[model samples]
Target: MKEYKLSGWPELPASYQRTAYQRMLHQMSQGFVPLGQLLRVSGLGRDAVRRFLAYLQASGVLVEREHAQTPRTLLVMDWIRRTLGGTGPRRQA
Candidate 1:
């Protein structure tokens, strides 16, 4: 999945005044946001997000990048979790 970070904040136009759009901008401003999570947050199709990101890119506000090490760490943690049966301390029984 793609990721985005808001390097610069730009006000959205009148036509783009939807809650989903607002939510996206809020999330983007927080830090690096993954496309999958954004999709869930917006509840819209990928095409719509693509267009939004494109607009941000054109406006010189969006940076398309990934947190390389974080995902790797998450993968290892998930594997360990699954291998250990579940989260936290396991039952003896």
Candidate 2:
């Protein structure tokens, strides 16, 4: 993995963003994110997530994986909910 130097807090919410980034990182560490799943997890629109994902990829925070039938993001989501102390699994319906 490449090293990325994240600069200054800059009055932006670094802590808040970092939490989400860490969750994403944890997911990637466990497996990999399938295309389009970041939007749902990050609560960001598709365009924004596309840009964020690109930035993460470039920054070495994330990597793109080969396409697959089942998205590993589902497992990540469950892990996140568990980590956050949420009750029950998140429902897609």
Best candidate according to TM-score: 1
Q: For model 1, how does the per-residue alpha-carbon lDDT over 6-52 read when each residue is reduced to its tens digit? A: 99888789867899988898999998899888889998899998899
lDDT of 2 by residue, 1-93 (tens): 122222321222354366555554444555656545554556656666556555665555454545543367768767787779876666678
Off by over 4 Å in 1: 71-93
TM of each candidate vs. truth:
0.71, 0.44
Candidate 2 residue runs with Cα over 4 Å from true position: 1-19, 70-93
What is the alpha-carbon lDDT for the whole of candidate 2? Answer: 0.52
